[model samples]
Target chain A: MTATVIDGRMVARGVREETARRAAALTTAPVLATVLVGDDPASGVYVANKRRSAAAAGIGDVHRHLPGTASEAEVAAVLDELAADDRVTGILLQLPLPGHLDPARLVERIPPEKDVDGLTTRSQGLLARGEPGLRPCTPAGVIALLDAAGIGLAGRRAVVVGRSTLVGRPMAQLLLGRDATVTIAHSRTRDLPALTRSADVLVAAAGVPGIITGAHVAPGATVVDVGIHRTSDGLVGDVDRAGVAPVAGAITPVPGGVGPMTIAMLLANTVAAAQTREAAR
Target chain B: MTATVIDGRMVARGVREETARRAAALTTAPVLATVLVGDDPASGVYVANKRRSAAAAGIGDVHRHLPGTASEAEVAAVLDELAADDRVTGILLQLPLPGHLDPARLVERIPPEKDVDGLTTRSQGLLARGEPGLRPCTPAGVIALLDAAGIGLAGRRAVVVGRSTLVGRPMAQLLLGRDATVTIAHSRTRDLPALTRSADVLVAAAGVPGIITGAHVAPGATVVDVGIHRTSDGLVGDVDRAGVAPVAGAITPVPGGVGPMTIAMLLANTVAAAQTREAAR
Candidate 1:
């Protein structure tokens, strides 16, 4: 039997529409300050899409672009300005900052309340403590995707492949928060397929192309592929879709799946940040 | 084959001796300020033992005991004093604060630098981000125990039975940080034995007595039991020792296992805090 393809674009639109409604209800316009350091083509595309999504959601976008030669202190100064700006409700620092700049230090400059990207130590700490705070977008989107599909996470044996701070680690924490028995397997994991075969829910975020084959999945288990690799044939995911689709119960496609959800969650987070600031006021 | 009993007391002694050597090299004595909000018999005993351990490690012990009727503000005040005191290298606010007080708020009052207990959100966040910072004691102790035993965590299947922020959550993160395939299983986990049996290194921190038996263990898998329940029959661990011993390669006994390691880690953290402060000075 073929697997049911989870429609991420449709889910993302729903999220964007919901976020727009929330933005309309706010007393003041929600402003998101987007900091883009350097002219990396990929980073530029990501920023442009984020800005477009913010506009669609009725959120104000404040773009701050710096040259490839911008110093760490200069980037930090821009973050400090946005963080202290009363008009700014959220801040997003487009990542992969020039090799000279330390992303962690710059991310920390975004005050926790306004940290829409949720890459700061404080935000991660809040997630770790299970406290209320902005969550990292990709993992948050993954959870939202699962919820939208009506997949029950509680008590499910969910296995996550990859342990990157941006996705894998937080993804495991989110699943565990929902009472799923979450396991994280990285490149160093022994007998990877053996472990994946035991998972009722499998998430692949190893950033490797077509790492998961049909042999890696348990029969009738849900698979969420968080990896997207650009190949001569275009975008490919971690899962070997052709091979695994017939065996798995459900799966998310590469470009349209986790990618759309990430943008949608960013919009949601921005609107949520505005509401939080408003409530505090 | 009978399992090798992990001698936690012996390991703890080694840790303390190493900590004492470090403390002796310090320019000034490292002071650990223990703040006991109420006269909880158990808390008092724990605090007393911690003080005794600190003394043995050549660290200074400063005890602050408040009445059980203390308000949240009063507890905060005590923590505030310890945080600002230049003499206090580390601050430990004993757990199970009076029912009236919110432990989270009081725990947050301890400065991150002096937060020896590592219960604050900042410390937990630093851990999540894999930034170098103080870690929660119990899980840190568990890692120390594993290291002292020459147990290789990398690429191993490590299952942690419990998801507490204090133990299970951090324990999973530590193992994941070390490149172990880490899984967090809680009360909601289905087919617990099936999961535990897959673990090369099984950690039981469920706080339930004798929750893991021989049937739950994979033959030759190392078991670390973190639960200790005092019954009329005497102290019992999460693992049914008599039943699991023959099947396991290595096992840690109840009282002599995690308990000593925890105290030893605390001393290590205290000395480390002092060193950090000294370096900054």
Candidate 2:
């Protein structure tokens, strides 16, 4: 049986439209400032995508670039400037900065209120406590995709096959917040199939290409693939689509699945951040 | 065959001895200040126990008592005073303040460095990130108990049977940090026994008395019971000792298990907080 494909691009569009509506309704247009360090081609492409989307959503966009050799203090100064700028509603720092720079130190500097990516310690703390705050875009987008597909999470056994701070960890917290009994499996997890086969909702975010296949899935289970690795065969996700698609009841395609939702969620978060500041004022 | 009883009291004593040594070594005597709002008899007993333990550990102790009708500002003022007081190395506010008070707001007032209880947002964030920071006492104590027992957590299947901010959530995070494949089951979880029975290490913190029994445990699996309930038949934990002991490899008994360890970990965290402050100076 062929599995029903979950269309993430379509779902992300609805989200972007709503974000645009929100941005249009605001008294002052929201501004999303992207801080890019170094000239990594991939980082440049990602920041440009985010900036273009923000502008399309009726939000102002600003880009701050730094040389590869920029010192920690210099990057910190830019963050301080953005934080003090009332016009800048959200801050998005392009990651994988030059190896010499400490990522955690810079992440901590993004004021929680303007942390659109929700990577700050304060944002994570709020998520841990089940408090209302901006959530990490990728996991938050995965939830949006699940909801859009009408997946019932309450009382379901959901297994997240990764534990990275960026995606897997926060994804489990998000599932738990939605009342799914969540399990987090990683490289160290023994008998991965046995643990994942018990899941009603399986999320593949292990970052390893094609780590999940037909044997690892439970029949009729919903699979959300969060991995995208550039392989010889173009791009593949954590799940092997060719092997598992027939066995699964529903699945998200790698390239168009979680990818589009991420940028859409970023737009939503930026607008929400601006609305919060406006309300506070 | 009977399971070995994990002696929490013995382990806790060892920790307190170390804490005392550290406290004695400090240039200025470390001080722990506890704010008790309202005269909750149970809270009073708990505070007194902590004070007695602190004094025994060579740490200075201070207590601030406020009437049940204390306003939010009044409680905030007390916390602010303690936060500004250089001599007070750590601060703990007794839980379950009068019904009129907002606990979160009060808990937020405790400075992260001085938050000996480790209930603050910053502490939880640090725990989530697997960074160095004070952890919630009960979960930290659980890890201490596991370590004392020489339980090998790496690559093991660990199931946490709750998701409370105070215990279950942090417990899962700590176990994950130890390289255990962690699954969090809660009240909404289905097929609870099937999930719990799969665990090589099962932690019962569901706060439901006798919720976990022999059927929920895998043979020879280590069980840590974190629930304490007052009943006519004496104190009972989430695990039915009579039912689970015969089937388990080792277990922590209710009164002598987690209870003593909580106070011990609190002392450890207070000393650690003091050491951090002293190091900065």
Candidate 3:
């Protein structure tokens, strides 16, 4: 029997619709500010998609582009300006800033309230402590997907195969917060299959394409793939979908699974930031 | 085969000696300030032990005691005063403050540099991201114990049976940082033994006395018991020593095990905080 496909686009659309409702409810529309450091084609496409999505969700969009040779101070100045602007509700800094600039230092400059991507140290700390604050979008999106699918996490054995700060680590924390017994396995893990097979809910975020196949999954277990790689064989995810789908109970597909949910959650965070700022005012 | 008993007192002595040397090397003596609210006998004993250990490690000690009726603002004022005090190298606010007062709010008030206990959100964030910062003492102590025992954690399966902010959560992060495959099981976990028996290194911080027995251990696994309970039979930890010792390769005993290491690490953090402040100056 084949597995039930967890459609991310459908869930993300529901999220975007809810976000639009909230955005419309606000007297002043929430604004998402995009900061692109270089002219990398892929980064440009990603930024443009986010801006268009924000607009569709009834959120205002403000885009700032920096030359490929932009200095750290120049980027910092732009962030400082957006951070101080009353119209800007949330800030998304396009990543992989030319190799010369430090991402951590620049990301920390975005005020935690305005950090829609939730990459700031302050935001990370809030998530670690289970405090009420913006969370990293991808992991938050994964949670939204799971909730929409009606999967119960409490008392479940959830294994996250990857330990990235962005996805794997925070994913484990979110699952743990939901009362799932969580395990995090990384590059140094021993007997990878033996560990992954014990998972009732498996999350693959190793950034390595086709790393998890049928042999690694527990029979009838729910699988969530968080990796996306452009290969000669078209786009592929961390999990080998064809091999694992028939064995697993449910699985999220690449491109349509975790990808769309990310931008959707960013819109939700933007509206939440606006509501918080307006409440404080 | 009998398990090797990890000698915490011996290891702690060495740590304190090294900490004293560092404290002496600093131009100014590092000072640890303890804030105790209410007069709980157990808390008083805990604070006294820490203060005594600080003096033994060549660290200065300052103590403040508030009556049980103290308000939240009163505790906040004390933390504020200590935060601004140039002489206070580290602040240790005794836990279990009056029920009316909020510990999390007060803990956040202490500057991250002076937060020796590492209970603040900022410290937790730094740990979650694997950045350089002071970590929670108990987990840090457990790591030191494992290091002193010459147990290599890389590529090992380490299961932590607790999800507490002070110990369990940070313990998993520390193990993950060392490249171990880490799993955190809490009360909501299914089949505790099945999950725990897979660990090469098992940390029992469940706060339940003798909850783990021989049935829960794999042959020749390293076990670190972090619970301390006073009972009719005497002091007992989360793991039943008589039951698990024969099955385990190594184990830390109660009372003289993790307890001594906690105070030792606090002293070390005090010196480190002083060193950081001095270096910045």
Candidate 4:
């Protein structure tokens, strides 16, 4: 069967439009404080893209960059200020900050209501209890893609490759919330291919290029690629598209599959963050 | 191959002796407060057993029951008072309260620092993040029992049936921490027998009698029964003990296997709470 490509860009555009409408409806623009510490070009580009996206979604209350040498105490203080500020509805801390700053401590400073990235301990607790909250963007994007692909999660077998807190762990919990039978696999896992073959739905989040191939896919399975790698040739996903496409009933293409969905969910979370803060008021 | 019969009562004595030794080393006894709502005979019996166990462990400061008609606000106030008091190192809230009461809400009210049962969202978050914190009793007890029975969790294939927050969910997390390849099975799980046949360690927390049988167990698989049923046949575990024993390497008996271990861990948590509070001072 020919694999149906999941169109993340189009879905993201639709999401952006909705966010724009929601932003316009509010008296104040939904502000997202973007904290970027280091001059890592990639991080800079990513942060810039987010600022543009947030602006496009009508999020105009922009708070930007801090120097790489900023002390941990200073970063935490900024987060605390943002948390206390009634004007700022969302906080986005650019990751891979300087070696010295404690990301967990700084991230925890973002109030649970304004934690659009869903990185706070409170957010984790809410998700663990299967309660509604602003969920982690990337993991939430995978679910959004699954929905777009018309995959039924109830009673389905899902194997998530990688067990990172940002991806695999939350993804498994999200799947379980939808009543899917979920299994989490990591580097320490034994017989990886054997475990992969049993999955009716496979989500590869190991961040390694081409770790999941055609051989690992169960025939007629829907595979969502969560890995992104850049090589001299081009970009690649965990799954080898050419090798796995033939066997997969429906598969998400690397560049277009899960990527755009992440941005879409980020917009969604920011809107959700706005609503959460609003609801509390 | 015959299943090893894990003696929970014997293990409990060992744990109590250790607790006693720790108490002797301390300048003062660890104080634990027990909060019981309503006079359900069964709940009263359970609380009484906990108090007796606490006494045997040389634990002190037992607080008596409050009334059944306690409002949520009232309960929260009481919990808040206990949490603020330095003398109370640990707190226990007996279950199956009045019909109108929300158990989750009440459990959430207990300060994570004083929650010996480890039922709070904070504790669950710590578990998810692989941080060291008090764990839910039955799940923690399961690991302790396995350790006492000479079972090392490294490289084991563990299958946990059911996913309740108290038992199965935390049980899976603990097993994963121990380096076990864990799979959480639930009501929606298909081909359970096939899955169970490959398990090296099986835990049944479905609260259903005889859900796991000899046929489901792989030959010489270690089984830990978490379900306790009070049927016409008397108290029984989720496993069909007679049929499963011959094919299993080790098994925990229903009434004795995991039951005593729960209270043992409770005592352990209380003592740890005391140490933590004192150190904080």
TM-score (all chains, Cα) for each model: 0.98, 0.98, 0.97, 0.96
Name model 2 segments beyond 4 Å from true: none
**What lDDT tens digits, residue by residue, belong to model 2 across residues A1-281?**
98899999999999999999999999999999999999999999999999998999999988899999999999999999999999999999999899999999998999999999999988999998889899999999999999999999999999999998899999999999999999999999999998899989999999999999999999999999999999899988999999999889999998999999999999999999999989998
Q: Per model, how much of the real contact set is kept?
A: 0.95, 0.81, 0.91, 0.36
What are the chain A TM-scores for all the models, listed individually? 0.99, 0.99, 0.99, 0.96
Model 1: per-residue lDDT, tens digit, A28-98?
98998898988899999999999999998999989999999999989989999998899999999998889
Write down the worst ten-residue block by lDDT for model 2 chain A. A121-130
Candidate 2 lDDT tens digits, B1-281:
78899999999999999999999999998999999998889999999999999999999988999999999999999999999999999999999899988998889988899988889888888888888899999999999999999999999999999999999999999999999999999999999999999999999999999999999998999999999999999899999999999999999999899889999999999999999999999
Could you tell me which residue pairs clash in candidate 2?
none
Give the alpha carbon lDDT tens digit for every residue of B1-281 in model 1: 99999999999999999999999999999999998877779999999999999998899989999999988988889889888899999999999988999988888888999989888889999999888999999999989998988899999999999988899989988898888999899999999999999999999999999999999999999999989899998999899999999999999998899889998999999999999989998
Summarize candidate 3's per-residue lDDT along B1-281 as a digit string, tens digits: 99999999999999999999999999999999999999999999999999999998889988999999999999899989999999999999999888999999999999999989888888899999999888899999999999999989999999999989989999999999999999999898889998899999999999999999999999999999999999999999999999999999999999788889999999999999999999999
DockQ of every predicted complex: 0.91, 0.88, 0.86, 0.60
What does candidate 4's lDDT look like per residue over B1-281, in tens digits? 67889999899778878877887677667888998988899999989999988988889866757788888888878888888877788999899789888988888888888889988877887777777788899899899889988887876778899988888888988888887777888999888988888688999999899999899999989999999989999999899999999999999997888998999999999998878777777
Q: For each candidate, give the TM-score of chain B.
A: 0.99, 0.99, 0.99, 0.97
What's the residue-level lDDT of A78 in candidate 2? Answer: 98
- TM-score pick, better of 1 and 3: 1
Residues A97-126, candidate 4: write the lDDT tens digits.
Answer: 889988888888888788888877768867
Clashes of 4: 1
**Interface residue Cα RMSD of candidate 3 after superposition:** 0.8
